[model samples]
Target: MAGKELHVTDIFLAVQVEAIVAREGAIMAVEKGFSNYVIESDSLQIITALRTTTTDRSVIGLIVEDTKSLMARVTGEVTTHIRRTANIVADCLAQFGRNIGANLTWFEEPPNFIIHLLFEDCN
Candidate 1:
């Protein structure tokens, strides 16, 4: 991790659970005291997932609800973006995910063994 705690700048809200997961993270941040945030992402799937309501009301629904509720509390507006270049921070975070390995330990810091994962097939 960096010496300074990073803030959620822009978020990429989409229909995909991955995007929702990021939104959920943003929501969690706001709950923790962040007054504003931006969601940046390039996935159309994730965007649609967030805007539509499906029958799949399992854990994902709970996440969506919790995220929505959290977003509702934010004084700032939730924004969206479609360009990959526009989402450097999120992409960086996703790259961080690549380092976490298969068994994702959300609460744990990413390990160095996973560094190679970032360079693999990276465009």
Candidate 2:
């Protein structure tokens, strides 16, 4: 298991940022040679955009399209919508990343700060 936290300098809308994050995550997964993976996001719009065949012409259309292209390269790829309430660990990590303003990756285990949240999430 691994987690990635990216800090972006440019500002974007919430949905756009979500799309960018999803795209980046997909890229990372492909780079790591993950044949099967799941992409979960609290943004329903992003999940819906990915699962659909229609083109998105909005501000995030390009990012969404690129994300879809990457998703095609992986076998058994699953994208799903998760409630923010159920995604505490991700939210905490995102905040932590923003606060430090750096890109971080953790392999095999999560950061100590979010360990408790992970346990709670499991429950």
Candidate 3:
């Protein structure tokens, strides 16, 4: 597992933060020599922008650009516009980030708190 604790003040929008997170995950995936992976996010806007592969001057646009660059360096498909209800595990992890402090964490196994949620997702 890999994640980051981002402060609210530095993030522009939910989609922007999501993009940043996706980019970070992709970079890690590349580092670990992953391929043909599926990157899922519940933010439709970010996903759509990513799929479009357009670069703009806005804050989120820069993030989108960065995300695309990272993804391009790796290999995978980005799954977007996932409904919140369909993404309970990711949702739970995002909530967990709130109290976890401001640091990036990487682990070899799933966080213990969300095992049930992951099971539920699989089922």
Quantify all predictions' global Cα lDDT against the true fold.
Answer: 0.52, 0.84, 0.68
Model 1 scores a TM of: 0.50
Best candidate (score: lDDT): 2
- Give me the displacement of residue 42 in model 2, in angstroms: 1.3
Model 2 ranges with Cα > 4 A deviation? 116-123
Structure candidate 3, residue pairs in collision:
none
Per-residue accuracy of model 2 over 1-123 as CA lDDT, tens digit each: 777888786765889888988898789889998887788899999999999999989899999999999999999799999999887777877766777877888767877756865666423
The alpha-carbon deviation from the true structure for residue 11 of candidate 2, after best TM-score superposition, in angstroms, is: 2.0
Q: Write the per-residue lDDT of candidate 3 for residues 29-122, one digit (tens) a residue.
A: 7777767546677777777777884575666777678767777876665555778788777776677676666655555675565676566643
* Best model per TM-score: 2
Ranking by lDDT: 2, 3, 1
